[model samples]
Target: MNRYYWILGAFAALVVLLAVGLNLNPREVPSPLVGKPAPAFRLAVLGQADKTIGPEDMKGKVWLLNVWASWCVSCRQEHPVLVDFSRRGNGTPIVGLNYKELRGDGAIDMRRVPAEQEVPMALERAAGWLKEHGDPYLLTAMDIDGRVGIDYGVYGVPETYVIDKAGIIRMKHTGPVSPQVLNEKILPLVAELNK
Candidate 1:
């Protein structure tokens, strides 16, 4: 019957849509912030209470804003790549945005700590982690309350942003920065942006 043919066609269309969706990479989720000005925030530098830094401080330079946390397992995976990049001293400074360091650590949950002591406790943990894992940041800023992360439209930890000399966000990598991603996508963009 004609009605049977219409139902079959609709089901086939739905199947095709689902198949197309499945082929898309989840990590390739497009960020709305790309091509926009990098959000501003002045937060205390990790392990340095007296110093605070923000995107404004890095104007006129192509820089990377890496969103990470001591608690992020994926952060650890991408850290070695960043460490090697920093060691190369390629002229692009990586400013770490230490996001939401309040949790992680079965022995002692930082979330249960007093509000006044939370930042300090988180800093201590982060500093220790960096010392052990190797720090790649020119200077890491503490986003204790995660307000800065929220402003930047962070979906989760381990996101990275490539900001141009003019402070516009040129590219946003939603997940860990592997060597392939660095060499193929990030480095090429940085080279072009610097020119």
Candidate 2:
């Protein structure tokens, strides 16, 4: 029947569309960098005089590299976990990348554009939020020009990386790095590195 064939064709097209949409979603791929040496470069911590932070600085210690921007609300959610990781991970250092910008102007820092519209929380509001919530970065690098993020392939915030003493990327976590990632991945790796 012609009507039956038309329905079948429509169903097939819908299936194809769903497949393509899901495949293109960034969340499907867990991480972009794992089991690779982290790239080396220096970036300045805004409002700090003489204390530039970078991959080279982390070479001597096992550390958590957290890529976040002022505008990322989810980053706020994971900030406390990062503070805990900094304390528990063999006193491992925490590196922060405030991604995207010509330079962090104290008001605005660089961040990526999300595929879907995130509830737009401006950088200023996010900064105030952090001050109220607390900052987790032991050494925060103001990633002006977004080059550092591009090097690290940080598509968006709340991404955390575990880096070993020799600068190898032990793990990469996409999305809000919860307490689970800290317990399962970060702490274990730091314990291993310390031993």
Candidate 3:
């Protein structure tokens, strides 16, 4: 019994050490998107019948992509910031990935798709959302099939990423971008891109 107790104690200590070591030695999983080019997507405005939009649409310009949904209140919270950010328009335009909406059809009539458990988020609502709050993004598209979201490693709505002029992702933010984050992180990053 004494020998068994000693063995159990030693095993417990080893487990604790391994846990602490693992936590300290964090590893960054190679994002399939890191070194290579970003995944291409072609989509259109919610109700506009004007033109088709795709990654190639903005080629040669530094941009930002936000993964958001109408059903996500946090996304709603971040919406206005996007508007404000666009108002700055430092040549870095913001775009939206409206996850939870179809496949194939580039033109997403927000009025038509099931809005994440049937919650509606029309372009008018998005426009109103910007009007009441302000407008930032130049392009906003419906990721009806969630394929774009998965490609960008999005586990939730309201996440934002800064894609460089070369189309490589330069930054990732998982929550609402606060004013502090904007001033401290976003501005500096954008400034560098501009130079």
Candidate 4:
């Protein structure tokens, strides 16, 4: 029947669309922020509430703005690579934006706590994690409540942006930064931007 043929055609179309989508890499999602000025933000340094840092501080120097959180499993996976890179003294300063810190290990939700206690609690957790692993950031800015992350169009944690000396966002990587991504994409770009 004609009706049966129409339904089959619709299902086939849906299948083709899904196949195309599945073949695409989620990490390569294009960002509208690319080629635009990095969003401006002045956030308190993690564990150092008295101090603050922002994109303006890094002007005239190529830098990496890495969005991470204590709760992100992927961030843990990506941390060592960053630590190694920093140890190499590549001259590219990496500024960490600690996005929405929450205890992700099936523990109490940090949101239920009093507002005044939130930052300290998050800082405690993040400090412990960094100590256990390694702190790669030149300075880590605490983006409590993730407001800065929202301004940067963060869909999730563990995102990274390469900002040139002009403060324009050159590249946005949406997922964990593997060693290959660092060596192949980020490092090369940073080298070019620094020149």
Which candidate number would show the highest TM-score if scored against the true structure? 1
lDDT of each: 0.90, 0.70, 0.69, 0.89
Best-first order by lDDT: 1, 4, 2, 3
lDDT pick, better of 2 and 4: 4
**Per-model TM-score versus the true fold:** 0.87, 0.69, 0.68, 0.86
lDDT of 4 by residue, 1-195 (tens): 999999999999999999999999876769999999999999889877689998999999999999988778899899999999999998788999888886433466655888888778889988898899999999999887788898999986799999999899999998899999999999999999978
| Predicted structure 2: lDDT | 0.70
lDDT of 4 at 130: 88
Positional deviation of residue 164's Cα in model 2 after best superposition, in angstroms: 0.5
- What ranking emerges by TM-score with the best candidate at the front? 1, 4, 2, 3
After the best TM-score superposition of candidate 3, give how far the Cα of residue 122 lies from its true spot, in angstroms: 5.7
Q: Indicate whether candidate 2 or candidate 3 has the larger TM-score.
A: 2
Window of ten residues with lowest summed lDDT in model 4: 102-111
Native-to-model Cα distance after best TM-score fit, residue 47 in candidate 2, in Å: 2.8
Q: What is the C-alpha RMSD of each candidate to the true structure, in Å?
A: 2.8, 8.1, 6.4, 4.0
Best by lDDT: 1
User: Over 4 Å off in model 3, which ranges?
Assistant: 1-32, 101-132
Residues 1-195 of candidate 3 have per-residue lDDT tens digits of 999999999999999999988886243333456445667888766546575577777778778888765556777676766777777656678877667642322455545666563323445455455456555667677676677788788765677777778887777777778778888998898789767
Model 4 misplacement above 4 A: 1-21, 103-106
